[model samples]
Target: MAESSPVRFGILGCANIARKVSRAIALAPNATISAVGSRSIEKATAYAQENGYPSTTKIYGSYEAVLDDPEVDAVYVPLPTSLHVKWAVLAAQKKKHVLLEKPVALNVKELDVILEECESNGVQYMDATMWMHHPRTAKMKEFLSDSQRFGQLKSVHSTFAYLGDTEFLENNIRVKSDLDALGALGDAGWYSIRAILWTTDYELPKTVTALRDPEFNEAGVILSCGASLSWKDGRVATFYCSFLANMAMDIVASGSKGNLRVHDFVIPFKENVAPFYTVEDSWFGELAKSIHPAPSEQQVNTDLPQEALMVTEFSNLVGSIKGEGSKPEKRWPTISRKTQLVVDAVKASIEKGFEPVEIIY
Candidate 1:
């Protein structure tokens, strides 16, 4: 790989999310789409054409073909949760860096296997948590870290929900027991859990207790659920995710001296700019008649969409390994594992009739 050449990415599926990511790869200056694969060669070819992939982009009938392509330096895996471990490990074994979709695995154990394969093969691995790459997220982190403004965190709450249509409720792979068994927890709650952990700098909670009476489909798949996480220092966080509510994505964090709120945490309502709210040193006037200084709005602008930024970041890491012979970045895989670990704990708590599950790591 030449220093001047862009990192070559091979997409492993024609999943809907992959369409968005393919555009991001095209937008990223450091990356380019090299190939796309599906079980059906015609589908792969059509996807490439429909997504405006370059004429040189290869279309393959199987994921293995993409991994075997010498020109491909990395693979973007948008496969379902059940297929992630197999394809991700195979990609790593082929020495191709992996950019995996969110809810990276069915469980932490599976995640560990994927990570081990990537480590042993010296390939970069990153989960597609695009919001982490957003400029607004960094700005919000700065506010949260300010001791004078935000003080010590006391509590946090996050929610992500979207009402599913009849077709989706009946046919979506997300609700399929054999495909995405984790259901809404893995799809929507993954973002909420990651957001909560991000506020605490990825610290594992001491315990997790799922809210009682989770709704389920006929196949025994979760349709809606919530959980509470408690830290040893008394910091508490709660999150809810569902496919039975109007679309909403929010995170509210309260501290000793300040509070923060964001209405759009998963995907910004707008692609170019994102806004958040915060209030510092809030107090009431005499007789609690009036509040002093209302919450302020902060907006951050981006040159490219967050997903593109994510691709650029992952591609940069792959480029370093390919061009400079550098070691794979550990930060990505570490955060991904921590997120999965917490997710598993929440699922365990639900299975145990909402009993509190202690987090070991």
Candidate 2:
């Protein structure tokens, strides 16, 4: 493949989330949708038509055909969690880069297997955590990294929730125990956990403790849950994720000398611009009447949506590997593993009667 060529994407399965990713792949300057596959040719054709795939895109009845297509440089896997390990591993063996959806696996053990395959096959691998590629995220990271602006971190709090209507609760694959076993924790909490880790420079917490009284469905899948993560230096991070609450995606972190807050950390309210707040070197007035330093809002603007940026970034990495013989990025898989480890620990804590679980790493 030429270094300047766009990475061709082959989407596996016609999942709802794939609708957004399909658009991202098209919008990305360095990527294109080459094929789509489903259980039936009719379904695949319908999906391609409904999703506005280009006429050049091929429709395959089975996922294997997409993987077998020589024109496909990569495959986007948005299949159910239970099917991830099987298909993702096969895709890697087939020499196709993988852009997998979040909650990468049911557990870290499963994720390791997938990551190992990608590594051995020398294929680029990245999970679809769109916010990480957003321009606003990078801007906020710049602010957080500035010692003069945001000093040593003290605590972090995040909440990601959305009210799932009755139909969605009953019909969505996320609530199905056999499909998405982690449920709300895997769905909403993945973002919250990622936010915490991102702000903390990808540091794994020392311990995790689940809050009491998690809500669950009849099939015993978690519907809502919260947990606290603590580090040895007294830094603490708390997150609440649910499918039963009103829509909210927030992150608030306080440092020794600065505070940072963002209302929409997962998905921006608007596609083009995102906002965040910060207060630095603030001090109470002489009479304790008011603070000396007022909080300021920072808005980051982008021409492309965050999801598109994600596709562009992933495609760039794919291009590098194919054009320059570069190794796959290890940081992404490591971050995914850390997030899953915390998730596993929180579930363990909830099952152990809210006991604090010590994280070995």
Clashes of 2: 0
Q: List the residue pairs that clash in candidate 1.
A: none
lDDT of 2: 0.93
Q: Per-residue lDDT for 49-110 in model 1, tens only?
A: 99999999999999999999999999999999999999999999999999999879999999
Model 1, CA-based lDDT: 0.95
Worst 10 residues of 1 by lDDT: 1-10
Q: Name model 2 segments beyond 4 Å from true.
A: 1-3
Which residue pairs collide, candidate 2?
none
How do the predictions measure up, each by TM-score?
0.99, 0.98
lDDT of each: 0.95, 0.93
Looking at model 1, residue 126 earns an lDDT score of: 98
